[model samples]
Target: MKPLNPGEPRQVGRYRIIAEIGEGGMGRVVLGLAPDGRLVALKQLHAQFAHDPRFRERFRREVATSRLVSGAYTAAVMDADAEAETPWLASVFVTGPSLKEAVDAAGPLPVESVRLLASALAAALTEIHRAGLIHRDLKPSNIILTSDGPRVIDFGIARVAEDAQDLTGTGAIIGSPAFMSPEQAGTGQVTGASDVFALGAILVMAATGRGPFTGPTAPQTLYNVVHGTADLSDVPEEIRRLAEPCLAKDPARRPTPEQILNHLGPVPPGVAPWPPAVHARIRQQDAEVRSVLALPLPVWRPPPKKMAPRTKKILFGSLAAVVLLLVSGIVALGLSIAEYAKPEDPGVASLAVTEAVSPERLRLTDPCKVLAGRFVKESGTLKPESGSLHPARCKYTGLNGVTFNLQLGESVTVSGLERTDRTAEGLPLLRSTISGGCDSVVQLPAERRFGIVVSRSGKEGDPCKSADDMLTAALARLRTHEVDRAGDPASILPLDPCAVADPAVVGKNIANAESAPRTLRICEWQGGGNTLTVELNLGAYVADGSPVDLGNGVTGDLRGAGTTKCTVHWQHRPLPNREAEHVTVMMLGREGSGSSCDPAKEIAASIVPKLPKP
Candidate 1:
């Protein structure tokens, strides 16, 4: 939370503002102290959106539904003024990071932990469903990981059951594609079963690290949700047995939340529901909020200058590089975090894993030959093309904008395996999609990037099935060996950019990034209408835009315009060093939406510290 700025009002109605919690396109949220000394999370809508009649109407309906939803697993709304000049609502303050944050940082949960999460969330859905409301968006971020248990939040898209079919069935696609139910992914009618389906997907993410239905883009993911089977290979058998039925493509085939409760039994009380690491994070959050409470109030404090992006300490750990391929909807960009946790320690605080080379490694000559039939020659299908030679890859074109990709890279150390979501065809795969794309890696003793990525060029649901299929097909053709050296990429190109990326770092900027392999060096993410693209130029790039002093003697360039034309650029491991490497992250968007450089700079600041020291 940030201190209130100059001119920022300290009072809102009967509550006094304490600190700024968060701000986004929709509105800003603050911590407020009620007259009785209780804390509340107060959300104030933007003036423009608040003034729109349609927005107000929707807000009014949502507030009413939100009030009706009450349970131990859900946030309780205390008050709201929908008709006010600027609409606002106050809910019991929750001090914790989101489930998305928890997983993105720490990776997936163990079986027991996932079971606990599923039980609590199932109970939450039961209460919400009984209230005649269907939460259209039920993904990881919507659930807050509190000290007690998980609490479901964000009901802006929650709809009354009766009208759901009428609106959602008309092909007006919405909701987070990764967690969407089959019907919710397309023109099919939505029902309570839809939420059930999403719950199943959520359980899979909690269990392994990813949702069941996945793809490269929203459309591709949704298509997979509608046409493909949920990949349960990675999920533990016990959880998978329960989740499998819930992910049925036909909504009617899924079980009700009440039925889920029967199977799950009840969550025990008074005990911590998460692992030691997750609980530690929860405690950290609580401590931060308590610290905020200790500050004095009602002073005309001087405006604090925006702090420059701080520099981090140099490290000398035996680190594995990452190659990240991020995808998005509103925006698309990819980031590779060469900085990571030490290989043996896969925790968020250290470098994770990416395979460079190992003695027990196998080399791949052609990655495209694996998917001989997955791509077809049709109206929109383009012939297959070979990709980079360093890490070897193949790209195939398909009809109606469908495309498939295959890439090969060396393994990250064994510590990297601790964070995998599930295993497919005996291969360990990183399950979760920070953005929305579907991707998987083959099981290799020493490598972290035996990967196959299936990304389309638009918004899609989680496309795990397609990725699974690609992996399965590739495995049929995969050949390995016992080499003399550790596994590493043959060359810079064709390497999985995501293998070297730090999700903890990227999650800080792009909350829901979906990525794909645009090329050997370029990875892209589709975000909430913004795109983030990253490339490793390897001495090919020469900065042209004016330099941005991000402080500490570091600089980056800003250039371009709009969603598709603008670019954000910066170099990693600058010149003068024999070991210097050239890497850049660029965001492309349409014109008139403000400077893309702003976010680009923000991303650069976050990524810089993770790079290897010169």
Candidate 2:
């Protein structure tokens, strides 16, 4: 989850948005707090879709049908507003990572966990099909894995079985490429059976990291969906027996959700459905929700009423007399207290030197910038490297490479560290020795801590002194160069990528183009058999690929993935901890469209100038 951006609304109907949860081609989902203290996952349609009357009518109908769906493994819809300017729907928020994230982090699930997942999803499909609706998009990303069980979510594309037309009426694909059933890829005649086929593909992904019919590209994958056989060689035998029948090309040959459930039987009692690592993620999300709820609510005040001339005069006269009396009382009180006031103890005064790091300041601190290479050059000719998977840590490389890590607003425990009677920027400094390296940490208020570690290749220099010097320099730079989102609202951190491109320009490249946010910082526009993607990212700026001058003092690295796709990457600015803010623009064209890079360059040239200057 990420904090809401600058232009994002704080409230949607009665639900107060806490943070963004996820985004997709259709809409974005956010964590919301309802009036009764219940947390919900609220999904709001993109403005482009809300403006279309046909899309709004379809969404209203789908929402009404989704409200009728209820089961042990499905997130129930709590509320909806299809008539609003930006239509939204709220559903019970389930705490867990999506199945895709779980698989990516922990590899494939074990046999027992896969069994439990298969059973729960089948039951969820049963409930959904019983509601007279077919879930058009049922991929791994739509399933949330909880400790108790798997809960299916994101019914944004579900519709009645009889409605066979696509949303755009131009035959654009609506579901994931690898997971779409053969019928959906070809004839577009979807039914309950299509979801079963998707379930089979998901089961294959859960047992193995790849889908059953996945190919080199999306078009190839779609073709495989229509013609190829299921690759069950990597799948465990136990799951293979159940998944084989579901993957039959003929829908009539596939088993119903009820049959699949009966075959798997009931989930075992008292046993956790997810693996230990997945359960740990679920617990983390649960704690995050609690912390968000504990924050103080924003105060709401009504607009002041205007008064007539006579009433204003009377009020001013009465306020003046009250101020005069209050001023006289304060003066008398100060005189009485001055005689009794005493100086504070020196020890007590010294203890108060440390400044508390406010939550607002911590949120805007870019971890990558805290220990930048320029600040650490005295120790060695260091260069910034790619950051770790954890967003709070950054790595540097040179004769003496170092890493800077931060743990903010969380309980921090330090062990094997010798306390020193020293301070860095008024905060207590601690030192520790490690294998071939030394570590130094600066302790802050509210359990926050920042550490710098220096590693020496040989026993030539004092690692502790290097660590300390780097930490001190970082602290000094942080005090002055901290990222200020309020002062620079135009920073990519707050701007929506979908709004960066001009609609007219986008249409000139691809007729009938429609935009959707693929993630918090990434957006995609698709039409006319072409796709353009814009992404705002933070990483090391590698000077690989061909350099193209994107006017306005900006240059980008252009690389081609294949004949049909090309991408351009450019660094926007240097961020904390050595990483740089960057932008990526990718273009994917139809099979015979020669040199996708031309169109990609054109689009990049148009949008790069619109971005905020470094």
Candidate 1, which segments miss by more than 4 Å at Cα? 164-171, 298-614
lDDT per prediction? 0.63, 0.73
Q: Residues 261-357, candidate 2, lDDT per residue (tens digit)? A: 8898877789988789999999998898788777765433332344577997999999999999986897877743222223121111111223224
How big is the RMSD of model 2? 20.2
Tens digits of per-residue lDDT, candidate 1, 317-413, equal: 2121111222232134232211111112111111112221211122323444445444222212233564332334556654455566665553223
Best by lDDT: 2
Q: Largest TM-score belongs to which candidate?
A: 2
How many residue pairs clash in each candidate at the backbone level? 91, 4
